[model samples]
Target: MTEIELNGSSAGLSGLTAVPWKNGSLNEALACYFCPQKTLQADRPKLGKVFTARNLSRIAGIEIRWTTNLADHLRLVDDDQVVFIFHCASFLQLQKSLDKSPFPDSFLQETLDTLALLFPSSDNETTNWLKSLTKIDPRLARCGSLRTRERRLENFNYWHDQLVILKQAFDESSPRNISQWWFDRRNGVQWYTFWIAILVFVVTIFFGIVQSIEGALQVYLSYKSIQSG
Candidate 1:
């Protein structure tokens, strides 16, 4: 606070003026870019299969909000000429930046809306001025579509890698590899049931033959007794 030497009898503040208030955010014009409106809270589902409908959104660098800053120059526009200058400059900057950045379509759309809200038309003359100058830039308009294609490619590659890993795991776990895995050098048991399994296999065959022979003998005896009677 700075106290000025004001003559007494003044009811207000006794001639003391507080310093200008400051905030944590950037300029109000750039507020939308720095701070987005609160999104509805929900559980973001993790990717499910190697391929899914939503993989693009998960894998691609999709920005639900503007996650990066604009060039410093756009912030330097004069207050009186803010609408006239920013309208053209922002679109051009966005187009150039899109070639290098992975900013999603939603980010661009919201940015435009924020700027519109910031500089609303006051009269018919200003409204017409805005239309002629803020005519949509072709390149900026295509950012959303380009981002969509890029996202799909990114998402597909993610699934392709997952599929490869899954295949390797499946092959390792397959029945043919089971006994080998169990008796691997890493196993502390250092014992294998390969021969024991073969012995049990032979014993099972012997039991089957014995059961077949006994069934035949009983059937033959029953036939002989019936014929004699």
Candidate 2:
């Protein structure tokens, strides 16, 4: 078991605190890589593997933290652990925001980009996980087992099917794309739609008023002409 000392306050290893891992030094490496500013001097709390549906958001936050703090040190960590963490984070993010109709395009694109970056190779544990998931739903066969990892998002139907399969497996209550096309409080989609509808209504009323004023003016001119005749 390799132990590494991580010190945020010092460039040298003088006041560094030694952090040990149960299995290997991968956990320490991850901690150093993600939370370099957090001091792990005394018996610091470790990230546990006991994840549940209720804790998905928290897990996603941890993963996001890792991504934001990522540096070249990522090359030194275990790929398997990295894949596991990314999968957990990405899946949880999708699950948490499933209620949003059509989904935010930016969010979806960012998630896909992160996936491509993290799982550049198709022969990794992530692909194997997807394969195992196929046993539960044959429809996931459309995902192609990541054979075309580079063009994973090209097939809309396949990508949608993958989302449906994962959602069913993890979160059942979230709405599908077509079901909730309008309101989404999380991403402020509902507010944007509401404001757009109000603007359209106001413009229509203004046009109607202008048309009425023109009709009244024409009628008055005709009456004046009849009087002159």
Top-TM-score structure, candidate number = 2
lDDT leader? 2
Give stretches of model 1 more than 4 Å off: 1-70, 73-85, 89-101, 121-123, 131-229
> Model 1, residue 44: displacement in angstroms?
32
Q: Per-prediction TM-score, please?
A: 0.20, 0.23
The 10-residue segment with the lowest total lDDT in model 1: 59-68
In the predicted model 1, the residue pairs found to clash are none
Candidate 2 per-residue lDDT over residues 1-229, each given as its tens digit: 1124334232322222234333445644534333413121212122112122112222222121122111211221231112112233334254346774233444344444434433433334434544565223222222222233333323332133322232233222222342232322233675577668878999999999999999999999999999999
List lDDT for all candidates, in order. Answer: 0.33, 0.35
lDDT of 1 by residue, 159-199 (tens): 22322332233223322343433423222343245555767
